[model samples]
Target: MADETPGFELPLLLFAGFRTLIDQLHAELARQGHPDVRPAYGFALQAIGRGGATASELGRLLGVSKQAAGKTVDRLVALGYAVRADDPADARRKVIRLTPHGVDALARSAAIFEELRAQWATALGPGRLRALEADLRAVAPLAGVRLDVPGWFGG
Candidate 1:
């Protein structure tokens, strides 16, 4: 018999699965001393990366206005997740870098994600989970990972 799932259901199901993972991540984060971290912050932190970025650079990476990026920086600073420091190569520029706290949160998130994936694998059967991942990789865009999801989602 042909699959009867509606075309519109595919994207919605994908999004729901993504939401489930994120929701589970945030729940774990809250228990591990990062209750304030939001989904948007994850994308912003990834954009900032190891070397860090100026507000303008971050804004471009996140596909948002400089002011929006600055606001995110402000919040990160207030939450002790990041700091603004003078760029060594360019004293006039201040770059936003992740703090130890932020690094810990990211690390914890990574571990938690692995656990979540394991849970999914157990539920769906390991072979099915692997197949799902392979199928997703095949269909997903070839442009590499994107860091502008927060802005794209209008968050």
Candidate 2:
């Protein structure tokens, strides 16, 4: 039998799967007291990391303009997920650091992602799920799994 699936369906299906996981993650996050955590915030938080980053540094890491990174930082501060602190190394610069609430949200997000993966393992069978992951890793550039997706998508 000839295969009829279009070439474009592969990327679409992969994106759809990603969307499903993110939607489910956010729903759980809302129930766990982070109702305002958006997907972009997650990426920005990751880029900020434990050591934190200045707006310019974050912009470079996230592949966005400094202005865009500043706007995101503003939102994060407003949402209580992050705070702008005077950089210890340089008095003229400010760094964006995740708050306790942000740390808690990131921890919860990690746990939730594991739970979701387990659910997928149950649905697809453990071996199949592992194989799927392996297959993806084989084809997908490992180095390309980055935190700049929001900017890459022009968000």
Among all candidates shown, the one with the greatest TM-score: 2
In model 2, the Cα lDDT at residue 44 comes to 93
- Candidate 1: tens digits of C-alpha lDDT, residues 1-155: 99999999999999999999999999999999999999989888878888899999999898889999999999999999999999999999999999999889899999999999999999999999999989988999546767888677786
Each candidate structure's TM-score, on Cα atoms with residue i matched to residue i, is 0.95, 0.96
Relative to the true structure, candidate 1 has a C-alpha RMSD (angstroms) of 1.4
TM-score, candidate 2, is 0.96
Leading candidate by lDDT: 2
Compared with the true structure, all predictions reach lDDT values of 0.92, 0.94
User: Which pairs of residues collide in model 2?
Assistant: none
Can you write out model 2's per-residue Cα lDDT over 1-155, one digit (the tens) per residue?
98999999999999999999999999999999999999999999888888999999999888899999999999999999999999999999999999999999999999999999999999999999999999999999687788888889995
